[model samples]
Target: MAENKTLKVPGATLYYQVRGSGPVLLMIPGGPTDAAIFAGVVPHLTDRYTVVAYDPRGNSRSVLDGPAEDVHADVHGDDAHRLLAELGDEPAYVFGSSGGAVIGLNLAARYPGQVRTLVAHEPPCGRILPDAEEYLAGTEEVYQAYRTGGVEAGMKRFEEFVGLSGEEQEQPQTPPSPEMMEGWGRIGGNLDFFLGHVLRPVSGHLPDVAALRQGPARIVVGVGDASTDRQYAYRSAVALAEALGRPPAVFPGDHGGFVARAEEFAVTLDKVLNAT
Candidate 1:
């Protein structure tokens, strides 16, 4: 069974869960979503490494001390540090997807000693993109669609970008809803945090990645098989791997493939984590 608990950070009450045993593994969930979004993959690995998944402040079970407008990456990163403290401050392996991958990369860059290995899957780092201008423009368009219309419209635009129609993209179930966002009024304060603190600073974020490349710390980039042609994530993964000078390892599914192919993905993930 999974054990749920809370950690009090600078301005947030972070809700996290622990399961399994062995080396610690921290899962950084994607943006606009919570840890529950990883339901399929989490359970499969608990029997090996202890898996810790938590919702960031202003999201699902977590709570914030200040108004949502005060949310920022410093607060979020500090919250992550606090959570690590509760785990005895021992360095742990981290697996992050999308926005969460961005966060983990930030953490690894900012505090290299905190992470043992980082498996960053498809971080949307505009700086690393060959055509960053066009990429940001597309991202802004999606954000506008979400803001002007709603999740449906935003998803529709996203589907179109990835060559999926509404009907084709629609699964039997819905992906987890985003708990906070830039346009939601709740996520307004974090925009500067995400862009300035995380983005602009990312240029020098992790010098240790090079050292890590030579040491026990390994940086693995992951892409999805199903997302090869139409997904920005796959392209991003390829770009990141190129930047890192390493070939990316293909994961089992598309963006959300980890959830649907949890068992197979989890096994592969375990092997990758241990190998690193």
Candidate 2:
């Protein structure tokens, strides 16, 4: 009922899993994490669609060369494109969370033809906000800490930024082993590159906030039910919905909504995605 495959992309080998049959839905994960984060959620949807989740070119099972110099959104976008191509030429519906959502937006903008529907959930594309300068500065601090002090420092800063609990923060705070660090470094490099090159420029070019207003392609903003009102993810979802002239549908749980309440989230997701 499940198959694992290795996909070779430009900078690394992507480890991915596929389940079920039907239209393909690409799930892009967040954090310094990978596909496994979606384990709980994938089962609920596999019966309705082909679910493809992969470790991005430098995370988890994926391998990469010495932290390729800065990596931009286009670089990450290219990986998504290559993975989708390998799966098949058919367009895919995409659901991306946090950093993944940011990547999804770039993919949609750059390769509009490849995306059938995009559920950009809680993207913290902070540059799109009115106070972008401060956000970028804070992000820079976190990246720098990660580079110098390691994962704990980086995660601490991230948790502070997102207002996560100390224990919840600890979940992803462990440093990557030396071997995994190489991949983390590559991913980190891309994160740095994205900050400078992609963030602001891409925000400036966003389609008329009115495009989603027409609804040929469903572009929905989803926020976690348990997320705090002030959390960046929730705020971003709110802002995106406002920009698109729509409202964000509440997902089943907190920021890791799909995983925390997989069954309910899948039901809601299916309803929303299939509505189009």
Candidate 3:
């Protein structure tokens, strides 16, 4: 069983899960995903690492103090910094998926000492891309779609934009286990908040190249082996790595690979973490 805990910080109360026992490895989820997104992989990792996963502020059990507003990467990063601070003084190994990757980068830039190694998986930091404006405008359109027709419309636009739609998306997907399904149930209500407040900010936010490069923490930009270069997030990952003067690390599967290919993803992560 995972130990569930809460930490009050500023306008929100963060809900996080602690599993296994070793050096801390914090997994940060993106969009509507919560601490549970890593459920499939955490068990595989527990033997070697103390796995910590948290629901981002305003998502799932991490409750906002009031009605949600447009949130930024820095705010989400601060929430992570506080969680790490509460966890221990030692810098933690971090893996951030999708939007979580963006937040992780921000945290590393702002407080480099708090993160030892950060594997940022497809951050969607379009601002660093040559065609950044187009992606930014697309995210804005996604937000507007939500405002116009609610979650259904928004997600349809989002999935298509990020290359998560149609027949291909169905293939190579690991069916969610009962635990993951239960986790999704808890996160279902988070979509509106995710679409409105989280998506655009993360998609448009720029990574601090200088801070990350100069920071003591080692940075690894990761992408899925199955992802096409035409995919915005895939390209973003490559671009971020180039800006950092390093090639992107290839993971096992596509964007939601942590879910679909949990076992493989965990093995790859273990190797990456042990490498440096």
By lDDT rank, best first, the candidates go 3, 2, 1
Per-model RMSD to reference: 5.6, 5.4, 1.4
lDDT (Cα) of model 3: 0.89
RMSD of 2: 5.4
Cα lDDT tens digits for candidate 3, 1-276? 789899999999999999999999999998898988888888899999889999999898999999998789999999999999999999999999999999999999999999999999988888898887888888988999999999999999998887676627523245677867888898779998999888987777899999999999999999999888768888989999999999999998888788888888999998887785
User: What is the Cα-based TM-score of model 3?
Assistant: 0.96
lDDT of 2 at 114: 77
- What is the per-residue lDDT of model 2 for residues 158-222, given as tens digits with 9 covering 90 to 100? 67775564434212223333433454455554444343333333333233344445544567778
Report, for all candidates in order, the number of backbone clashes.
2, 0, 0
TM-score of 1: 0.79
Better of 2 and 3 by TM-score: 3
Badly placed stretches (over 4 Å) of model 3 are 170-175
C-alpha-based local distance difference test score of model 2: 0.70
Q: Could you say which candidate leads in lDDT?
A: 3
For all candidates in order, the CA lDDT equals 0.66, 0.70, 0.89
Which one wins on TM-score?
Answer: 3
